[model samples]
Target: MGLADALAEWTDVDGAQYELGRATGLFADRTFLQVKWVLWSSNPLGQALYDMLHALVRAGVLEYRDEPDHQFRWRTAAPIDGLDG
Candidate 1:
């Protein structure tokens, strides 16, 4: 699989990917976390997940998934309505 897909599978319930996919409807959403917090946090997996999410977004494979309650990061479904491109 591609790198972004690989990272999405690696994420957890609060994983940026999971959150992003959940916010697919969009209301001007974004996902941001303090890098310092991640650096200090004891969870290596959390940091890795965040890093992966950011990278995926930067690579243009995904975007900031927004909402009223929380922001998420997710890849957009292609515009083709599941038709093969």
Candidate 2:
């Protein structure tokens, strides 16, 4: 799923996810390079974005998919225990 769609459908804080995706252009561009640049940049927003995604993964709401070419991707996993979606 797209970042915004996954964020909206699966996350508890949809507004924050959408805002973060907009701020980082992650919603508009899902390329590995874009993600790498954002995460590696000096911007504090990058860290916050990374932290939130990490937490989602830990909570089993998302999962990482590593491509053969080393692309980093995230997709919605199984729904969590309490969330309806």
Candidate 3:
């Protein structure tokens, strides 16, 4: 199988990927803690996951939102299209 297929199977077998699936469908603003929770669900000790999120914010692929509920730290952004190009 290809990389994505393999990764999907791995996450599926581990049951930790459910949170990620749920996160993708969230249309409302998401908090930092919520994003952290989703990332942590896959691997709590994965510093790379946290770093990747920070990188996205830095790249403007993800933007920080000042939701009243949050103090404005990487709170929300829809993933932009065609950044890979």
The lDDT leader among the candidates is 2
lDDT tens readout by residue for model 1, 2-47: 3345334334325443344334422124333423343346677456
Instruction: Mark the regions of model 1 whose C-alpha exceeds 4 Å error after superposition.
Output: 1-41, 65-70, 77-85
lDDT against the true structure, per candidate, is 0.44, 0.51, 0.37
Per-residue accuracy of model 2 over 20-54 as CA lDDT, tens digit each = 57645665745444455555566776667757766
TM-score of 3: 0.29
User: For candidate 1, what is the TM-score?
Assistant: 0.37
How would you encode candidate 3's per-residue C-alpha lDDT over 1-85 as one tens digit per residue?
A: 2222323322321122222333444312654455555544655534444454446457754333334321112223335564321
For candidate 3, what is the lDDT? 0.37
Off by over 4 Å in 2: 1-40, 68-78
What order do candidates take by TM-score, descending? 2, 1, 3
- Where in model 3 is the C-alpha error above 4 Å? 1-45, 65-85
